[model samples]
Target: MKKFILDLIVKENEHINEDYFVLKLTSNDKLPHMLPGQFVEIKVENSPTTFLRRPISVNFYDKELNELWLLIQIVGNGTRKLSEVQVGDTLNLILPLGNTFSIPGDKNSRLLLVGGGVGFAPMLFLGAYLNDLGYRCDFLLGGRSEANMVQLNEFKRYGEVYTTTEDGSMGEKGYVTQHSLLQKKQFDMIYTCGPTPMMQAVASYAHKRNIACEVSLENMMACGFGTCLCCVTDTVDGNLCVCTEGPVFNITKLKWQI
Candidate 1:
């Protein structure tokens, strides 16, 4: 595992209600080559409750700026403290961990990218990566309210963006699955990350259509690397480490029940 002392070059609160912050870290050395689904373990220096680092998905990267972006929702003490990080401060990170989303092999591959709440992190990068691989992509975002949605512009560069909020204040009033189904279109593959139920719903829809789907699970984890074995999950294959074996897994390989 490569360790880096990076500068917290930029920090901003993107969404007010949810306390979602977009942090940019710049490394003095070459930034690790990261993939869509990989995450970084960050230590929120000097916190009582948050002793161990928290794992957050890599949201975006700009090679020219030598910067990496993170979409962090301030849930507890760790994130609350992370929100306070200012420009030029230092943060320790172990990055490029966990497996990443697979690249489509064909140019005409039609792809659907779905995300819910802060779970939208990886899917943003996934959409861009898939587009770079010559696949046509469409993004569907779901949130409790418009305030909970973030990084919307990032996905627009990849493909069409469709949104749904629990309340009627946003694009579509309902869930993301509803918006996706409304399109009434079939895709060659599906990729998603979000709350358990949201991902499950998308998986069900894909399965019923006999389309391939992959899910990036958001499990509570520590040692974001594989050594801790804290991110163990039961799958059709066997017990697997979400940190190592996957934060990304094919829906068919998961043991989800009806």
Candidate 2:
């Protein structure tokens, strides 16, 4: 698909917590189509320290509203600056970049969606899209505690939601990989995005059962167009740019230590 650069106005800037926010953007022109696993690179205006744009996954999009949702964690100077923008502020972005996750072709396929932190960003889009296609979409999300878990209610709108917080304050008490459902390998495919350790564990578990699995890598990206090679990861085929080639990779395609 072709990519486009546009300045989208912020329709809403909702703070989910001190560390995270959801920015809803609308374009003056019609919005370009973007898949669930793809991301956008936003120019960080007015922040001197933020020279490069930040890459954030597409949380969801509404065609009728001409709106796109970006679930952002304020982890650095760029995101912190982005968090301060007001409604009606225009954000310059180059987007609809990178590869997308595979959707099930079979209507009755069962799938497990796993996420952690802001990595939970893309699963909502993937799950809701899958659910609409008649696939069983189940979510397993992990955070440090109840205070850290954002958009639980939003996730539940798409599928059966299971949760795990490091503190025993939520649905399950450990990492998502420890959830009993994951151990059973009952799903047709597993899709995950999160901390490297968490994703590695999920991939390893699925690999052991010979189950299909895909992971979205949140590598530090400089140029979203893959010019910088800053986001390349070691794969069986050699180093590949996470920005252009993926933020999503099937387990078999990756050469994880698993």
Candidate 3:
């Protein structure tokens, strides 16, 4: 896909919780075509301590409104600075970066999307894309607690929503992999993004069941292009840059034990 560096106006900076915020950005011109599972590198304008642009997943895009949503978690100085932007602020971004989740061929293929914490960002876009294509989607989301589970109703607009939280303050009292939906329903394909351990477990479960699976790795992608090499992951094809070759990869191509 073609990449573009554009200044987007922040229409809203909604604080979902103490840790998470959603930045709704808009451009005067029509936005470029972006696929599910793609990301954007934002230039932190005023944070002197931060030298690199922070990479964030595309949470959702509303073509009708010309808005792009970024679900951000304030983890460091860079993100902290970003979270402070006002409604009229201009955020520069190199967008539509990285590969996308593969769409299943069969419309009837059962699909499950698993996400944890802020990793739930991309799953929303992916689920919406699949839902628009007449494919059924089930979202299995996990977080530390109910506070961490943002945008539940928005996700439900695209598909069935299931959830898990470590504190038992939400839908289920365990990890997403432990959700009862997995046991009750059979999925033909599974897509996941989360902490490494969580995704590994989900991958393992899918592998054992002989289901097609893909994972979006949360690697450190300092540069949205391949030059950085910071987001490289060992795959069956060798070490590939996640920023360019992926952020998304099929389980068979990954070097994960599963």
Candidate 4:
């Protein structure tokens, strides 16, 4: 897919909570084709301490609205600066970066989308698209607490949303891997993104059941494009750049011990 350095208008910047915020941007020009797992590198402004641009997943895209959503957590100086951005502000973004989620094309496809922490950002868009495709999709989100399990309502609108809170204060008392949703149903595919351990666990479960699985890697990225070489992950195919080659990779390609 072609790339663009678009200075998009910040249509809305709403803080979901003290820890998370969602930014909606609109492009004055035409946007390139953006897929569910792809991300964008936004040049951060007003933060003297941060020099590098931040890479965030494309949360959702509305073609008719010409709008793109980025679900972000205030994890560092760059993100904190972004949280302060207001409507009408222009954000320079190198976008439609990385590869996309592999949609199960079959109408009867039964899928499970798993996400941990801020990893949930990309899954909503993927699930929504899958729903549009008439596929049976379920979402499994895991966070440290109910507070971290931020947008269940939005997720529920797309498909069945199951959650796990580490503190036992939410949907399920254990991690996402322990959620009953997995045991209650058989899935054609499992797509996940999260902490290393969590993803590995999900992959192991998928492997044990011989289910096709793909994971969106959340490696630290500097450049949105592959030129940076900072987000390389060891794969069966060799060291691959997660930024460009993927933010998404099939579990068969990964060399995890699981």
Candidate of highest lDDT: 3
Better of 2 and 3 by TM-score: 3
**Pick by lDDT: 1 or 3, better one:** 3
For candidate 2, the 10 contiguous residues with the lowest summed lDDT are 179-188
Summarize candidate 2's per-residue lDDT along 154-230 as a digit string, tens digits.
98888899999999798889999888777655888899999999999999988998878999998988898889999
Poorest stretch of ten by lDDT in candidate 1: 7-16
In model 3, the runs with Cα more than 4 Å from the true position are none
Cα-based lDDT for every prediction = 0.83, 0.90, 0.93, 0.89
Residues 1-258, candidate 3: write the lDDT tens digits.
889999999999999988999999999999998889999999999889999999999999888899999999999999999999999999999988999999989999999999999999999999999989899999999999999999999999999999999999999999998999998999999999999999999999999999999999879877889997878999989999999989999988888886
Q: Candidate 2: misplaced stretches above 4 Å?
A: 183-185
Give the TM-score comparing model 1 with the true structure, all chains together: 0.93
By lDDT rank, best first, the candidates go: 3, 2, 4, 1
In candidate 1, which residue pairs clash?
none
The per-prediction tally of clashing pairs is 0, 0, 0, 0
Looking at model 3, report the run of 10 residues with the lowest lDDT sum.
221-230
Candidate 2 clashes between residue pairs 3 or more apart in a chain or in different chains: none
